[model samples]
Target: EAGVVQSPRYKIIEKKQPVAFWCNPISGHNTLYWYRQNLGQGPELLIRYENEEAVDDSQLPKDRFSAERLKGVDSTLKIQPAELGDSAVYLCASSFGRGRSNNEQFFGPGTRLTVL
Candidate 1:
């Protein structure tokens, strides 16, 4: 019944540096997603995983961003050579199923990254 958990609620780094965020989803959830929310905007899906497989990642920035859910439980998102525009809240969510009808995602307190 616990919600997803994310680490390092806030981070600040210089541009061109590297940073990483971590997430641990609910115990029974099988699907995980990473999202990014800019100021005054809704969360945008960056990548999605069903178990250890990455099922949807079209929106992810392959050049600088990467994600992985190794054991289908906890996940990590990383951004290398971070840019100033990369400052945003990175959210982690999970759901019990992949089907839209039964998928009710639980979100974690996002990690707010500030690229200076």
Candidate 2:
């Protein structure tokens, strides 16, 4: 079937503006994840969802970043009052099962956000 889908492939906004991203995972996948990747660095997990429940989100900056997965299918991530330091690639990935050791995650093209 299809891989993950994300919208607004690219976005440019001034500092303090609000930005949101959308994601649709492959059918039959039970796990979803959101990650932020900085230039020259690997992706960092922002949140992980097992079904509609958020199982891991310790790394998410609750002050400005928030995410949700409804009915265990699609998800959305939002950043309010964006900061220059928040500019990065936001990725959405999905897999068949929970945890990272057993399954392979399929990633979307990602939404590149730029804050000026």
The residue-by-residue lDDT of candidate 1 on 5-114, one tens digit each, is 99999999999999999999999899999999999999999999999999999999999999989888999999998999999999999999974525888999999999
- Go through the candidates in order and give each one's C-alpha lDDT: 0.94, 0.94
Instruction: Candidate 1: list runs displaced more than 4 Å.
Output: none
**Steric collisions counted per model:** 0, 0
> Which ten-residue region of model 1 has the weakest summed lDDT?
96-105
TM-scores for all predictions: 0.96, 0.96
Best by lDDT: 1
* lDDT (10s digit) by residue, model 2, range 1-116: 78899998999999999999999998999999999999889999999999999999999999999999878899999999899999999999999988663699999999999999
Report the lDDT of model 2 for residue 86.
95
